[model samples]
Target: MLKNLAHAHTQKFGKGFNVCNLNNMRAFFLAFSIWNALRSKLSWTHYRSFAG
Candidate 1:
């Protein structure tokens, strides 16, 4: 199922649509949403490692 979704994403979005990239994208958005809720003033660079 994940492979199918990744293949579709690759076709639609171009390269770097593998499982790791997909999971990273998900983690980024999840972290972004949480940051928005908390209104963190920290720079993204500072928390980038935590995001991934």
Candidate 2:
């Protein structure tokens, strides 16, 4: 499913939809599953660091 989604995303968006990025995105989503639990002042990189 992730492979298919990655292919479609690349076709539509042209780049940055590889399996590794998709996996990281999934991890980020799982880590921050609660929308309100996110800190408003933190950037995505910061969140990514925390998630990692």
Candidate 3:
């Protein structure tokens, strides 16, 4: 399973593989949203990593 996942990531970033998985896209969007919120001092969703 690890090997398959690694291959998927390699193919995903390689040439001619333009499709991005939904999970990856969601994560990318969420990351940017968090960054923007931090920079703007705006309301932000809770980050579980930092939550008690």
Q: Against the true structure, whose lDDT is highest?
A: 2
Q: What's each prediction's TM-score?
A: 0.61, 0.79, 0.26
Model 2 C-alpha lDDT per residue in residues 1-52, reported as the tens digit of each score: 9999999999999899999999999999999999998889999899899899
Candidate 3 local lDDT, 1-52, one digit each (tens)? 5446556766877643234443444555666656544544433344423321
What is the per-residue lDDT of model 1 for residues 13-33, given as tens digits with 9 covering 90 to 100? Answer: 999999887787687788776
The segments of candidate 2 whose C-alpha lies over 4 angstroms from its true place after superposition are none
Off-target runs (Cα >4 Å) in candidate 1 are 34-47
lDDT by candidate, in order shown: 0.76, 0.94, 0.48
Q: After superposition, how far is residue 41 of candidate 3 from its true place, in Å?
A: 24
Q: Model 1: which ten-residue window has the lowest total lDDT? A: 35-44
Give the root-mean-square deviation of each candidate in angstroms: 3.3, 1.3, 8.7
**lDDT for position 43 in model 3:** 35
Ranking by TM-score: 2, 1, 3
Better of 1 and 2 by lDDT: 2
Rank candidates by lDDT, best first: 2, 1, 3
lDDT of 1 at 6: 97
